[model samples]
Target: MATLEIKDLHVSVVSEDAPKEILKGVDLTIKAGETHAIMGPNGSGKSTLSYAIAGHPKYTITSGTVTLDGEDVLEMSVDERARAGLFLAMQYPVEVPGVSMSNFLRTAATAVRGEAPNLRHWVKEVKGAMADLDIDPAFAERSVNEGFSGGEKKRHEILQLGLLQPKIAILDETDSGLDVDALRVVSEGVNRYKASGEVGVMLITHYTRILKYIQPDFVHVFANGRIVESGGRELADVLESEGYVKYTGSKEAAALS
Candidate 1:
């Protein structure tokens, strides 16, 4: 139903001193009901793409355009992007020390939906979502991601994904630092969201382990600030068997090859 189009996007950031470009004329498109996985090496600009799309101030788009359903995305503020149906599951979810989970969720849903969710129904929804995510009832009383473990933080991110139900979900390293059990649980939550057939997913990850749980319709290989290759699920399997040596000529990968 919705289409996210990226046309020749170029992004830059301040690294210590001068401005350094991270994304180089990146062009991609994702429609509702499609899942795209972006895989790449450490410094290959994977996170940069997500941040730029999410309208983070750190990454500046010096060229090109991003549109959601043919509407300009770059012109909107970060919060406006969310209301425009964009969701980003960050690699490192920050801690909001004073905000309780329930209030935070309610406030966010209120803003994104343009009106406050009814108290009674919202409570039921939050409880149901938490139960499905295996979160304790008492957990909602705690501050958001405050002192939570790495796996807990990741689960919390997936929890938001299930609740907010954005059009385009950009998950950056959702599998990082998760145990086998945690990975499966989070992946299932993502699967449930994608199953709706109305959400376009842009999942960015380094390993293929999560792919086994959440299948991607398309896999894109990012290298040196650009997409080097794009293919089907078989591309990820290929990467698992043969590392990124083909796209990246790093000594570490060559030794493995």
Candidate 2:
């Protein structure tokens, strides 16, 4: 089984021409078939952990080691990380104007798969995946995420997830803008991808609603800059009831509440 191990990760970003630390010695291990829910308040550096692991240029990994099945992840480029079985589903997926979703997805698949998939089989595969997600067939010809609704964008993220089939997936607030039905469809897509029991998932969210659909094996409470508490699925119920007041203090938690 694949393993993504993070040890004493410290990350920083340039703010006001100075380095500002975000992640303060985070340590976590995710193995295949496990879903880890990272729950935290806003500005708690939850997204930072995802971006840092995916090698975002803005966030610098000052100290720590991230290894994918024992391979150094920090040494790889953003695209290299994807090819190395590390996938990141962004909270806000970007728009690629003028590039058709069909073209974009196939190119990405080619890069990751090391060769272009057969056109005959690729079309059928893409159609099947899109149909499973309740996506319109016309979307294949549309510019990537351009003029798409919040739900549409989120669905496409999961579409990529299903197609690429990476070893480890970092999903950043996938439930942020999704409505009740959209949330269910998106969650189901994620569930389908991880059903193989060979994928490790890091699901980051502030609310526990998504957990209702895609249950997590582990729940982690992130406070300040690192994980403060860890537990099982029941911990989400605790968070839903008490909120993050216990971790972020009453003042900060109240503002978010």
Candidate 3:
């Protein structure tokens, strides 16, 4: 089974001409067939963890070891990570103004698969995945997220997840900006992808609503840039009722209480 491991990860990004540390000694392990939910307050480094793992140029890994199936991940390029079965669904999906979704998906698939998918079969594959996600067929020809609504962009992210079939998926705030129906559709899509039980999922979000659709094997609480608590599904229920006040210990969190 594939495994992604992070040990004592420390990450920083330049802010105001200074490198501000975000992820402080984050250690986690994700093996195939497990779903781990990372819940945290804003600015607690949830997205930073995703970005750092995906090798986003902005965040600097000060010290840590990230390995995929025991191979060093920190040494790989962004595209290399994807080919190595690491996938990240960004909190804010970016728009590719001139690239058609169909072409982009196929190109990405080719890159990851190390060969071009059969065109006839590839069309059927994308169509089926899009249909499962309730995405309109018209979207396949549109510029990637150019004029898509927030929910549409999110569905496209899941579309990529299904087509790429990565070993480990890091979804950062995928539930954000989704409506009730959109959330269900997106969650169902994720559930379908993980049904094979061969993919490890790291789902990051602040709310427990998404958990209602996609059940997690483990629930971890993020605070002050690291995991503070972890438990079974019931942990999500606790976070739902109590909020993050206990974990964050911030006036803002207390006010929400």
- CA lDDT scores, all candidates in order: 0.91, 0.94, 0.93
Give the clashing pairs for model 1.
none
Q: Estimated TM-score per prediction?
A: 0.96, 0.97, 0.96
Residues 139-231, candidate 2: write the lDDT tens digits: 999999999999999999999999999999999999999999999999999999999559999999999999999989999998777889999
Ranking by lDDT: 2, 3, 1
Q: Over the stretch 59-167, how does candidate 3's per-residue lDDT look in tens digits?
A: 9999989999999999999999999999999888999988999999999999999999999999999999999999999998999999899999999999999999999
Give Cα distance to truth, residue 49, candidate 3, Å. 0.4
Error of 1 at 87 (Å): 0.2
lDDT of 1 by residue, 79-120 (tens): 999999999999999999989988899889999889998899
Give me the overall lDDT of model 2: 0.94
Off by over 4 Å in 1: 250-257
Where is the poorest 10-residue window by lDDT in model 2?
248-257
**Count of clashing residue pairs in every prediction:** 0, 0, 0
